[model samples]
Target chain A: MSGIVIIGAGQAAGQAAASLRQEGFEGTITILGDEDSAPYQRPPLSKQYLSGEVGVDRLLVRPEKFYVDKNIDLKTGTRVGSIAPSEKSVTTTGGDRFEYDKLLIATGSRPRILNITGSDLEGIHYLRTMGDVDGIRESMGSASRICIVGGGYIGLEVAAVARTSGLDVTVLEMEDRILQRVTTPEMSAYYHQLHAGRGVNIMTNTTVSGFQGNGSVSAVLCGDEIIEADLVIVGIGIIPNVELAETAGLKCENGIVVDDHCRSSDPDIYAAGDCTNHPNPLLNRRLRLESVPNAMEQARVASANMLGGDRVYAAIPWFWSDQYELKLQMVGFSSDGDSSVIRGDKSTNEFAVFYLNDGKVVAVDAVNSPREFMVCKQLYGKAVNAPDLANPEFELKSLLN
Target chain B: MPQVKFIEFNGTEHVVDASKGESIMVAATNNLVPGIDADCGGECSCATCHVLIDADWQARLGARSEQEESMLDLNPDRTDESRLSCQIPMTDELDGITVRLPEFQY
Candidate 1:
């Protein structure tokens, strides 16, 4: 049997392959990846891995032997050129065609490149894959001053690591504050203070006009101001790799549009991870999430549905980021809430921000507060007293009862 | 290297050698012992690596930290023996410690 053929050997692809085997699918599984290495976790690329606390071996979702022992044919560095959905086959860039009874499109996303003058210069790097991080690590060896363009989670995370590594780090955010797109004003202020206190210079309301250098990047030009830099890292964001899916005649919105079952417009085709804009029944909305938890969970659901089992992907979205010594864990969408109430003491840097709308808890942002974060995860769509949430002595567990 | 015994929900048992200082989750994932997802890669944030330790070896492995306890508290399948495998480092003391994998992570 041609069995199941999965595109993109990422977190979603690895999980889907494992989940299928777990569900007793005794069929051939083939995973196609453009990267030279096997599937690995990307979260640490900006944290421990970049900080040199962990190595590439630990980043693997599963060891190379896993594919061998599980009898999974993982073709690394093989890019699928196009999909002949009608024929149930895919042609790779190398001109090898693989026929499949079932196909899973998990092409994932790519780092959005910064296009401007001198952006093509050497030493300006973007973090997305292992090779990208390896290039940045090599640049860090000879770099003294590093300028980060973008104040998102990635930029701040890389800033934290660079600052801790004793490099002169500066973060330029076009927005008024860092994390403006994903978090509230209070959270943005908290991180701004946190990074500044750690000796990382943060420039808000700043725009990068272009990079300044001949052969290698030496400075970043912001309008008329020149920020001296030995290296430049851009963390603008990512674009979903949906070109293949779109070419295959699959529905494509902001991402590959899929149903609750993670099935695309075609009945036999399924998609997951950063590339799919699936529906969340709990949130009662459709959105694309760029998170490992979402990717893994959706893959599980997609796998089940692929095997003729009914499974809905309605998980409450969650994400975490580690900066300096603080751990920030968030659940649900902060945008769904109208107002937010702070729990615990912000001065001590241990607290939870509960977002509420119409007296119902919609989401939470827990900082160094996993106990409350765990409890908050269960509080989604529940009505709770705001005063009790703000009270430090109030028992959050009682709300469940 | 210390040895770790992982018992799947289906009563299948696999005993593998685990290096000291590495976590039981690492041993399970590295050994290709299914059921331990460890999605967060030992970050303790994702509770996918939840496992129930044998009652006889619970005290030997020591108690879970407050963070670990909080992460475990969310799991409906959690019991007195439940622990995040990522938090339990495989030391010489835990050479023959046995852990049972849960049926589902969530």
Candidate 2:
């Protein structure tokens, strides 16, 4: 057999390689990553790594010797130019060709770049890769005033870090409240107060019309007003890397369309992670999650199916964000929640909001309350009494059943 | 710096010096010790860094907080001495501490 060849050295690809080996696949395994660095955790790039709490050595998913010991071929800094599914082969930018019995497209996602005027100005950066964080870190030292263009997790986390480092930080959000896109207004209000209380200026309903400076960004034009800044970090969001899969005749919608098994249109080809829009039976819709847990879970399912094992990717998606000292852990999706119940006291900064749709618990967003979040995660898609859920005195552990 | 020992379920042992203020999970992952996934990167959200502290060293590590205790409760193989390695910070008192790995952490 020609063995399995994965075309992305990210979280999904790394997990796929490891899971394949653990599943007793003795075939030749090869991974091609565009990045020069080995497969490392991306979650810490904004939190621990950016803050210099963790070193680069600790970010790796596995040690350098792991690939060698497992007999897996890892090609760093190698980009796959195109994929020919008909021939089961892939061509690289460096003019190399390889064939495989099974192929996985774990290309992942890229940071979304704003196309506004002066976006290319110096001193403005996006946090995505190791290099991006390094650039921001270098800029953070000499910069006293920092402006964040988005109020998402990345922007908020970076704001928290910058403020802790004694920088004057200002966050610009186009929405009426921060985290409005993914969270309820109540949750967003809590964060707004948290960041504002920490001496960070958070401007909601603020649009960054453009950037202004002499060679480097010194201020951002937010509508009618201009906010002064020595540095700017844009955390707009990310775009899934689907050009390669789309060009290879694979189905692509918002992302490369994959089944519950993580298989693409081609029989011998599969896709996973942030690049694939896979179907979720629980939600009754297709989801493209940009989370590490989603990536790793899909990779495991894809790896199993690649080895001819029948497995479906059914995972309860969970995400966590660390801002200052608050640990916000969210499970399930709360987009379509019709009703929400707050479990803990919001004034004390310890609470969890449970989202319900059609009387069933669809999601839970817990801040500084992991225990409630853990219990709510198990109750996904199950009906629960909202009053009881909102009652702080209720024993949450007993409701797990 | 404090020295910590991590023993895999398969009987492989690794002893390394750990820096103060960093979590024990960081020490294990930094030393390339196997079986301590710590997938959440010390967030205590994921219990991938589940470890059973040696009975003798349990007191020195102090009591587990309610959050840490609940996180460890998610693990099926958790024991009375079970603690999330990510929750324990490296200190001088934790030097010479031994934590045995679980059969698996997911």
Candidate 3:
């Protein structure tokens, strides 16, 4: 049976396969992944995995034996070269063609490369895959200093790991402050102080002109000033892997354009995860989220729809980051809110920042405050009293009732 | 290795062997037992790995950490026996531990 073929083995691809089986789709399921390893979780690649807290076995979303027992044909190290929509088939770079009754594109995303001089230096790296982290870990053993470009979550996370490993860490951000894109000035300042207090050299409003080294990267050149570094990690951002969809006559915007059902232009073809710019009914807008929750939930929705079930993907986007002892849990888009209220003492390092828009809660950034973060997930678009929200003594659960 | 008994919401039970120091959530996910999402990969950040410890084994499991308690308190389905399975590591004393998966994670 030419049943289902899923491309790109990631959270979405693995989840789609599992959900399909759970939905009792008694058909052939094949997952094609370009990476040699089976479907693994990438979230920990920057934190626990890089810190040696977790091993490769723990990174796997499911055990290797799972695919075997579930009768799934998982093809690893197979890169798809092209897709023929009319024929409903995909050809790999190795010239193998596979036909599918239903095609799921979970191509995910890749790190946006900084194409400046010395970009191809050996010590320069980006943390998007397992192989990349392995390279970084190898370099960290001999290296004493690490310069991370971009002050986003990945950069800050890497910096935390680097500092904890006893390496000199410097974070270079082109923006006025770190985490400028996703968080507010106050939050950015908090993280900046947090990193600085941890002995990390954080440089804001700093731009890296290029890298300077003999063979490997020895320094990051910022105009005339040179920041000495044995290794450099660029976490600028990620670009959606939408070239395959674009070439196949599918709608392509910043990402592969798909409806709420995760269906691309083609009726039989579906897309999920970072690759698809799907619509979120909760947010009332189309967004491409590089989040595990979004990926897994979209996979479930797409899988159910593939099996003739109508499941809408309408989940509030939430994400978390681990930096030392702090666990930052965020829900919804903070940008959607007009004003934000601090729920607890930031000095204690246990507080929740509630972002409200017109008296309705829009988002929340909870640091070491999972109780408030969990309640905030359910408080989206609901009107909340400013005084009650700001009072730490008042339980957030009461607002729900 | 200690044995973990995972009961699904629908009453299907699957017992799997778990190594010492491995969390109950890991044992379930590794054994291909459905229900435990553990989306954060045992970070204790995501409460998707919520499970109810068998009443007989509750006292032996010890109290939940402050973080786990806060996370569990947010769950509407959480009872007194509720615990994030990722926080419970397997040990020789915890052999034959029985836990039930909630009907829904979110």
Candidate 4:
């Protein structure tokens, strides 16, 4: 009996159910989604949706008819409260309980809120869901000034959109540069120029002291000054939705700790997505990836393992970001790298930066350069024999077809 | 433009048009092929555009690069028949090609 119950119906949860069926698992499958809508695409929220290129219906992950055709029970508008590991069941906040032979916790993550005054203001928004985007888009029209907290991908993307929409955009980041935590120093500097050239004021090493308005966030308070703002968007980071797993007595570290197979400490239970931290062979560390590809891959692998398939969750880490016609694609973990080399002209908006750890190619960040990005995927475990940044003779096809 | 037949796991037939110089990945993306994600814009950074060339016409396609050959190892259900659609540049000689997407891509 499959009797598989998946919680938090995002990409991972939805994919796990589909994968389980695809793997020939004949067991009953149930999906619980907190959002009222069916599984929808999230990446487009900041790009097409935020830019008003698409509508809510277009963001749907799949057609409603497909769920019925798959013989899967998708329960929307449902919030799974707590899990009972001993009983192998999940109790919903609305008092409904589901018993399962196997459980996959894909609760994912929530936007980390700014913990200062005026955070509770009316015009401020944290874009993690469709509901959040709807609110922000509706309020954006009348907004004269938009103050964004954090200069990460989400914040910068919103800043670009706000600036394009004719709003005075100011980004306050506590870090030295935008995307400093994830990308290289050089990459950060490049984006700094790109955003500033677009008329977005990026204030680094600055923290929000408080809010200036009486109730509805008219201005944001910085060190010794206040910047007028009619709208605020906080995109600091994300906190893993690990409270349910923790309350259920699962092994919890920075995220819910899972083995290579994506199975939690509770043998029958599995965890995927941002909520689960698994051993990364490439990184050689147990870390959580807040990326869609990682979440989707791990969920598929977990499904395979649950169905008696001898599949181990093994793949190099990769992530991507889209901002202002620039597509940045990254592969492998580059945090441990000591040196990096540029392969093309980033000024022309086409380049790949290869990260090397002791002469071994560990990671590559490609900005609008798909050819080198393809080569970097092939050269992941290869040694960095040629570390020259401007080597035109380095044929990417020969390196990686 | 040439028409190629794409056979799905459940035997659904999708006849798609292929441009002369565009890679199969680009053609599939143009036709909105279900499984070929081509996430990295077909740069090969992401192996999501993987497909197994039809056994009958496998030899018709050029030999995979050492890089493409190595990248094939990263694919989940990799077989000797496997090829990344991005690497196989489309041509008139490659018309009537049929490729099988891995079962996992859906």
Candidate 5:
């Protein structure tokens, strides 16, 4: 057999390679990464790595030796220019062609850059790859005033780190509140206060009209005011890398559309992680989750199906975020109509917000309450009363019973 | 690099040269030590990286945080020595630390 080939060595590609080895597929495996280093975890980049609490070595999903030991070919700093589905082959930027019996697309997502004037300024940056963070870290030392664009998880995380590092951090979100696209108003309000209390100047309903600088960014023109910034970090959002999949004649929506089996439109090709929009059978919907757990889980399922396993990927999706001393662990997807119940005291930084729809526990967002998060994971997709969950006296573990 | 020892559920020991300040979960996963799943990349949200520290090294490992305590409470194999390996950094004091992976983790 020609063996398996994985494109884009992010978390999904890394997990797919590791899973193939674990599943005892000993033929041959190859991972092509455009980054200079091996596949590393991105979660820590905004937190530990950015704050210098951890080094670059700690960010690795697995050490360089793991690939060599598993006899997996890892091509770093290489990009696949195009894919020929007819020949079952892909050509790299350097004109190297490789054929595969099974192909996995995990090209992942890129940070959505701003289209405003002075966006190309040297000081304006986006955090995505190892190199991106490395550049940000270097700039942070000399930057006393930092203006962060967007009020999402990435922006909030960077604000938390910047505040701790004694830098003047200002966050500008076009929306009325931060994380408006992802979380509930209660959760958004909680974080808004959290960052505000920590001395981060958060400006919501604020949009950066343009960047004002000489060669590097010095100020952000928002509304009628110019917010002076020594450095700027844009964390608006990400767009999935689907150009290759589109060029290959595979199905591409906002992301590569995959079935329950994580198989793409092409039988020989499979897609997983951030790049793939797969069905969430549990939610009865299709979601493209840009999370570590989702990426890893989908990759596992994709790898299994590639090895001829008839398993359907129906696991509940969970996500977590760390901001300062608070850790938010969320399970299941919470939609707008889902009525929510607060389970614990929010002031103490230990609380769990349970979102219910039609008397069924649809999702939960737990902060500092790991036990509640764990129970919520077990109770995922099950019907439960909001009053019972809201009642503090009622034991969460009893729901499982 | 500090040498950290990881013993599997079946008593297979793997000694890894862990870099200073990196978590034990990173050390294990980087070195291909099978037992530490660390599904959330050491966010302390996932209990998959749970390990039982040896009595000799318990004091040097520091006190468990409230979040770690709550996470350990959910695990069926919770013990006095059980810890989320991601929370334990590889410092010089933990150079010779030995931990046993729970059977459930494997």
Candidate 6:
């Protein structure tokens, strides 16, 4: 019997396979992935790759040689259709059968496309996979004006890239401000300023009716404003790829439902990464994190559990986004808080905002301030009595120490 | 070019020629130091390339920017001496400096 079998070839699956071996699971390890390419970092694909600062090769999480060295049977371009809990096996899309002692479902999420009119128009792309980036990157060359449907990280990141390349970029968001759902209004104002300063027309509280063109996206019609565009990148968000799990009779809510040990309703089957909706201790709620840190960490925790080792996957959700020269680093959920203190000048786009819930620091958003972000991730749930974080003499290092 | 003493990880220190314009991470990566994994490629995105600045050299390198501070905060078990090697650019006074990497990049 195969010692361990992990479905989905993304970071969580890749890490789980490797960790199982590292933890001394010598039996057959099979990692099934839908994508042909090896597991690569998705965060960089939107930033450095979009900016042309890093090459494609550097995006890979690990080289092909590492898999060979680790003796991991890295099965690329393979998709697992469903899992038979009673038989202790998985059936792939190609009808190949694989039996396993332990199963890990790391089937990651995919971009949620708008189901509206003109959604099928050409030149309208969703930024999710490697192929999507290639499509957007290629179109960016000739596209004079680009309309990004969502004001999320991916859309803003692509906007930065397009603006840098001298393409007129316009971001359309239905919300009152960009990142309204994810970050504080202070953060929204800061990022909004930075993007607008870069000549990115951020149109918030405005909805895109749909695309306008015969076969291709020529303009995005929102209200009365018909903005002409050569290309449209939709980065609204991602819906967990829970179809496989749901079909397999796994309990799924917003995402693939998993317990603390990352075990699906089936004891033998486990899930991790962006696809799984696990309970977050930090937020005291069930939260689905779509970040690399969460994916990689959960993979490690889940892999240990699969090996019969007791390990709980509890890590603060952390993510970073690079737009132009600004690095936005966030740790924990700062959605709705009692107050927030700005640590530096927002105009210069270099500062950290401490998100306080009733007096305790619940989360932090660091704009171009990574070290403070690093410290605050450790200080989560701590009673930080800071009257004013913007006090010039107040150092984040002391709070950490 | 200024000669700075980089403990070649051999326990014995060796002096390598570094230009003033380059960052310490750039100098170390360029000189083929095994420890520094400058994954962000000197952009200070990932905190992989972490190092401890020599106490005496701390005053000369100036203070860590708020951006650098936030990045370092994400670093596990960081120190006052902990500095993202990418942020510390080599300068005229940064000679004879030494840095040590943590046992495990945990």
Best by TM-score: 3
lDDT of 2 by residue, B2-94 (tens): 999888899988998888977888778656576876657676787778999868899787699888987766455768889999889999988
TM-score of each: 0.95, 0.89, 0.97, 0.84, 0.91, 0.84
B-chain TM-score of model 3: 0.96
Model 6: residues with Cα > 4 Å off, grouped in runs: B1-43, B46-106
Q: What would the per-residue lDDT of candidate 5 be over residues A280-316, giving only the tens digit for each residue?
A: 8788888888988888888888999999998788878
The C-alpha stretches of model 1 lying farther than 4 A from their native spots are B1-3, B7-22, B29-37, B73-79, B91-93, B102-106
Q: What is the lDDT of residue B43 in candidate 6?
A: 61
Off by over 4 Å in 3: B1-3, B12-21, B30-34, B91-95
* TM-score of B-chain for each predicted structure, in order: 0.96, 0.94, 0.96, 0.90, 0.95, 0.85
Judged by lDDT relative to the true structure, which candidate is superior, 1 or 4? 1
What DockQ was computed for model 1?
0.50
- Chain A alone, TM-score per model: 0.99, 0.98, 0.99, 0.97, 0.98, 0.96
Error of 6 at A154 (Å): 1.2
Q: Score the docking of each candidate (DockQ).
A: 0.50, 0.27, 0.60, 0.12, 0.47, 0.23
Query: What iRMS does model 1 reach?
Result: 2.8
3 versus 6: better DockQ goes to = 3
Per-residue alpha-carbon lDDT of candidate 3 for residues A254-358, written as tens digits (9 for 90 to 100):
899999899999999999999999899988999989999889888989999999888898899999999998999999988999998998899999999999999
Selected candidate, larger DockQ, 1 vs 3:
3
Which stretches of candidate 2 lie above 4 Å from their native place? B1-38, B51-62, B73-78, B85-106
Question: What's the lDDT for residue A360 in model 3?
Answer: 92
Docking class of 2: acceptable
Clashing pairs in 3: none
Worst 10 residues of 1 chain B by lDDT: B69-78
Give residue A274's lDDT in candidate 3 (0 to 100).
Answer: 93
Q: Candidate 1: lDDT of A264?
A: 95
Query: DockQ winner among the candidates?
Result: 3
| Pairwise lDDT winner, candidates 5 and 6 | 5
